[model samples]
Target: MGSVTVYGPPISTAVSRVLACLLEKDVDFKLVNVDMAKGQHKSPDYLKLQVLSLPSPLLLHHRTPTPSLLVLMSLILTAYADRGNKNLLGRNGGGPAERAQVEQWLEAESQSFNPPSSALVFQLAFAPRMGLPQDPAAVELNQAKLAKVLDVYERRLGESRFLARDEFSLADLAHLPNAHYICSAGKDDMLASRKNVARWWEEISTRPSWKKVVDMYSAPPA
Candidate 1:
């Protein structure tokens, strides 16, 4: 098996999300912290790994080149068997219909949930910590956007136990990192205001994998 290395900051929700997935799948990985504060992620060496992108927490599979499909299948089977969770995104990921549903919610998390949630966290938490001014307009805008997104979640969750279905899937796991930070930032009311959403959040955020990540990386109180 090739080595798996994750490159990013410990506190970054994006990095934490990947970590939670890896942990849930019981994959052995190496965490290579990139100091964004020192602009290490922007260095030429780091940029080469990421190519033309700036997203941190890049996952690199280290080994001699081989058939991509075989590598992917092997990794998936190994992780799925180790964790015994059939709903994660691999060989055990379910049938076509279920897989499509999971993909849909995963897309929602990346597009709808992440933008406003991440923006609010940045405006309320990271910006101030970095000595950057918080823009009231941006904060208000993102809050409203997140509220709308949660409204949809509330409706959907009322109909189903998990986002994609009754089963716990990657769709639900996708929300943990940013949701943790946002809740800690004092906007938990956004989740609590929606009964089903709150229930769902409570369930997913308490998983052992996420608990470990939070224990390791959550910021201290101001």
Candidate 2:
């Protein structure tokens, strides 16, 4: 099998999501850190490997680069079918209904969950850690937005153990990195308050794959 390479900082939630998927798929891969503070991701070499117009955390397999998380997960699944882990996407993830549902929730994570969670992480955690000023208004706004999104998730999760279904899928995995950050930012109440949402978070966030990713990025004990 061709080797996999992931390019992005470990602290990046998107990058962490990709890493978690790769780990869950049991794909051997190398991680190349991109220094966003130094604008390394904007370098000419990095831009060529990435779609440039889309997003960061490019996945490269045998020199072919793809920016789609779905594509990245599919590639790993295809390469390792003998590993017998077919449920990540679902039974025949390519099937019309399953594919659509998975894609829909994936979109929700990207559009709905990520934005506000990112805002909260930046304002509440990243800024203070970087000695930058946190914006109270931005923090409040994102907190409210995240609360609303979680409310929807609580309802949806109450219907199903996982976002795409009772089985764990990429849809639920996608939320891990950001949701972990939200909790780390001392906003666990957002999740703890919602029984179903908290249950869902606990289930996915404790996966061995995510635990490895967390250890990889965790700060050293003081």
Candidate 3:
């Protein structure tokens, strides 16, 4: 098998998500930095791999490029689960029911959690860094939206240690990157204010695999 190469900087939420997944699955891969600031993502070469201009990570393996972030992570998780890394999918070898539950939470994260969270991350964190003006209305709207989502998560997490069940799965992993930025945006209260949600966040965000991803973000460029 050829080496797996991920194109995008670690700061990108989608890229970090894939990086953390690869770490959790114990997969070795190379990182090829894409400076979105420099419009590198718009380069002809980068666009060739991701024509959709999706702000997601691009994965190159065996000369094949996977452009969709969800597809890339799904492929990694399913491939590893089939190889005995069952926890990536769900608890107890991820039976059909458990797998279904995992997919449910994954959908919730994508549909419910991601929209508001990503908007807030962009408005509060990225805007300031990129010299773009933050939109106050957007921030307020997304804050309310994310809070509502977290309230539901607090209730669900009270019953289950993870989104799907008592075991950590891709469902929880899927939220790590966005939630990390939400906290970084100085809106940690959205997560920290809810007890069960806070506890869940602590557990998942502190996982050694995720910590490694954070370290990668801070690592000096080669």
Clashing pairs counted in every model? 0, 0, 0
Model 1 lDDT tens row, 1-222: 566777777688777777777787777877787878898888888777763464546777663322232233345445456455667643366788887888899889988998998898898879988999999999899999999999999999999999998888878887887888888988899898899999999999999988988876744421
Error of 2 at 186 (Å): 0.3
RMSD per candidate (Å) reads: 4.4, 2.8, 1.6
Ranking under TM-score, best-scoring first? 3, 2, 1
Cα deviation at 181, candidate 2, in Å, is 0.6
List lDDT for all candidates, in order.
0.78, 0.83, 0.87
Kindly report which residue pairs in candidate 2 clash with one another: none
lDDT of 2 by residue, 69-113 (tens): 667777777787655446777764447788678889989998998
| Cα lDDT, model 3, residue 219 | 76
Taking all chains together, each candidate's TM-score versus the true structure is: 0.86, 0.89, 0.94
Model 1 CA deviation exceeding 4 Å by range: 63-84, 89-91, 218-222
Model 2, TM vs. native = 0.89
Indicate whether candidate 2 or candidate 3 has the larger TM-score.
3
Summarize candidate 3's per-residue lDDT along 121-182 as a digit string, tens digits: 89887889899999999999989998999999999999999999999988999999889988
